[model samples]
Target chain A: MTEPTLQSDLNSFDLKAFLTEYGRLVVAAMEKRIARYPEESRVTQAMRHSLFAGGKRLRPILCMTSAEAVGGNKDHVMDVAAALEFIHTYSLIHDDLPALDDDDYRRGTPTCHKAFDEATAILAGDGLLTSAFEILSHAADDGLLPAEKVLTIIAGISHAAGCNGMILGQMLDIEGEHESLTREELEDIHNNKTGAMIEVSVFSGAYLGGGTPEQIAALDVYAKNVGLAFQVIDDILNVIGDPKVMGKAVGTDAELGKSTYPALMGLDGAQDFAERLINKALQAIVSFDNKCDPLRSIATYILTRSR
Target chain B: MTEPTLQSDLNSFDLKAFLTEYGRLVVAAMEKRIARYPEESRVTQAMRHSLFAGGKRLRPILCMTSAEAVGGNKDHVMDVAAALEFIHTYSLIHDDLPALDDDDYRRGTPTCHKAFDEATAILAGDGLLTSAFEILSHAADDGLLPAEKVLTIIAGISHAAGCNGMILGQMLDIEGEHESLTREELEDIHNNKTGAMIEVSVFSGAYLGGGTPEQIAALDVYAKNVGLAFQVIDDILNVIGDPKVMGKAVGTDAELGKSTYPALMGLDGAQDFAERLINKALQAIVSFDNKCDPLRSIATYILTRSR
Candidate 1:
């Protein structure tokens, strides 16, 4: 597959507008549905605080874009899209906990535990994680998707979030702290920790969109490249990007002694590597027509944006 | 429903033999599966250590008996039974962590974190929790049950394990620490933390056994009674029972200033309360034929046994 040539500049894409308009509605709906968990218990409230915290709903947007790219209804995919956001948000909450990364801030606000108690933060993470499947199961029962497809989506999401993927990555991340990590070690951690879920976002949407096996296979490749590129850029930004734009403490990697891509590959080499992966991502989407433009734009956008 | 007359006498039923044999096999299987995560890896090994440490497989046995009482195959329910165990084990791992109950010993061995480290213990809990759903999903695909039935079981299990149930109970339990809790407050915590999952076990087997709605409703009542009885007895044991048979430190409740039934009600009063709930549990299952005798016997066993 050849890389798709860009018709418009990356700066022309209005991600802020896309996220603010459609993303806000999607996230609000998600928070409302999740908040319906009986009485407004402390656990539920903590989960809502982290989940509804404002951010670019990139995962959900990817779900919607993948659905639209395949001529599926954006509205039909909305619940599943929101579910993806919950999973992402929950991971972030747990990752920031004292037992984990011990971060004080997330998305420009005090972390969940900082806002609440450590125990509340833990339960909040558990609540969000479980609620993701709850949302999917409820949507399946409501006929948002076919039972078989819903089963597939549920299984896929669980695998991505579970031991063989995200949890395993997290274990490695915790173990890797303050220790020198090999290049391969860094790749494994980021690939599973971040890449697996991102891949699930794109692949689940594609599968639910009724993409052909070949198309789904192609999207997997695209997703892996884009996921890695996303992380590489994140590492680069950690060192050089403005804290105002990132909404997180700058130089956290340096302070934490984290093994990041830029630390291992150097800034220039990491930039080149990200560009190559972005090119590969763009190339993977070449089988589609103009409908795939947004996907192509997203790949470029991953590297072009400062945050 | 009439009160279930104890089979001739208490000695006529031998729960020890039943639990001993099946519990051993269940623990062995669980240990083997957990060990597969790699012993060289300290994190996975810590999870395995706590998970595999010997404990009575009472919950899974309850599941198996319920399936058998409804004339379902025990082998068919193994996956569901294991899933039940996984959820229970995950709860224990999390509860024992320093951030939660901070217990040093569980099942006569060092807790997961005490055996390894805090971060490993956390990941282990997360891994086990996710594995429960993974096991259930795989069981469904392997033709253990129909897709619809599998979805029902998964939905039920998730609901019991999620915010409305176990997590909420845990949150309440944590909040209740060092505070004077009323009887109602203690009951609410146990009902969700312990009762919800116990109810799920019975419901899972019955649903898989193709039980009628009426039967399911009856079993739900039965489960609620036994679940409360189990906790009440636990509280009583903490006050007066032998720690050797209990296999863990006792009287820690008072030391930690945690609320308990025995703390609110005297030891004798707690025992009386437990007996009343045991009778109530038996009443709930009176409509079932002799096939349910094991469940009735188990209910009696719960209140009378040293453990």
Candidate 2:
């Protein structure tokens, strides 16, 4: 397939407006996907607490944008997009558990476990994770996607979030607390822990949009670069982000002796690394037309965002 | 289709031998499905810890038996069976967490949290849970089942084990600890908590085996009845069984001030209730011929087993 020439100019693209508009749509989809159970069910309550806890819906938006970038319909990818958000939300819930990061706050609200006890929080996370597959699988049932495609999407997300992916990353993150980690070790953790899901989220959307093998392969490059850049920016934010804006304590990573990009690369070096990663991400998608503006702008935003 | 004639006699059928043969096969499949990651991976270690801790393997066996009873190939259903065990194992890991049931021992060995750290235990459970779906969705990839059927099975199992099912039951269970529960309330808890996954396990097997709609409906009744009977018997065993044989502490439920069948119905009444449930379960599948003898015998054994 011939690549479409770029149409939207990066300089004029409003990243905040794109995020706000698409983020609301993703949240609405998630709200419908996550219905409140009757009788004020604590599990549902806890799930919704974090799910609606006002983060930038970056993963789902990235998914939708990836679909759009390939000239595929975004509507066709919404369920998968929402599924990505659910998986991300679940990870956050579990990460905040008393036995894990033990953070009491997230996205300007109390963490699920902090809000509704650890057991309920755990169940809430489990519920969201299970429901995510249910939602993705339902794409076929709803005639939103083919059964085979839905299965593919399910496999991608599950593997990305499963033991060898995000969970593996988490295990390393926990272990990293005990001792110093080399830059390679930290990158490995970021790749598996954060990068896998982010990569899957991007490519799954492209696949849903019926992107060609070449386009999908290109998106893989774009997603890896963007995913690593996202985490590096997060580490940078941990060092300089305002507590009020970030909605959690800063320097907790340093306080806990956790290895981070900033710690390993130094703050200025980490900032430069994030900039390079974003440029690499943009370069990966440059073959696509101006339709890639959302993705390009999002990559740039990831490097520049304060919270 | 005409129902097949009785091929096995309950009185003459050796339940132990059947369990032994099929159970070993199921365990081997589970072991293969749950390969350990290299370099003594702690997450996989914790997952293997509880996975191999030696439960009865009744769920997977029931899945296989249900396949056979429907004249479908049991080999076609093994992936789903392994997935069921993964889900069950994940639940056991999370349920034993210190923030939850807080038991140190499960299946005659240290719980995942006790064997590994609590954080590792949490990720291990999360990993196993994610892997279950990964394995289920892989059914199509392996040519073990059709993508559509696998999708249906995924939906059924995810829903049955998700918030509205097992997680919902757990929430109710936690709340139950705070107050005296009515018998009906307790039953509702048991049905969702214990019965949902059990019910889905049976029906998923039937679906995988290509059971007729009538047969599938019949198995639903069998599953629900058997599931409740299993729990009722669990309560009875807690009161009467030796801790060494039972492989976990007895009377811990009473110690925790949790309600049980015996607590609500007295020992004799609870035993009678279990007998009735099993009888009901048997009656539901009585027309299926002797091929169902494994299921019927399993229900009977639920009442009679020491552990």
State, as a TM-score between 0 and 1, how close model 1 is to the true structure: 0.94
Q: Write the per-residue lDDT of candidate 2 for residues B15-68, one digit (tens) a residue.
A: 888888888888888888787343367898888888888988888898999988
lDDT of each: 0.80, 0.87
Native-structure RMSD, model 1: 4.0
Angstrom error at residue B151, model 1: 1.4
- DockQ per candidate: 0.58, 0.74
lDDT of 1 by residue, B217-292 (tens): 8888889999999999888878776777667788888988999987788887888999899888888888898778
Give the residue spans of candidate 1 off by over 4 A.
Answer: A1-13, B1-13, B28-40
Lowest lDDT block of 10, candidate 2 chain B: B1-10
lDDT for A159 in candidate 2 is 86
lDDT by residue (A118-144, candidate 1, tens digit) is 878877887777777767766667666
Error (Å) of candidate 2 at residue A74 is 1.2
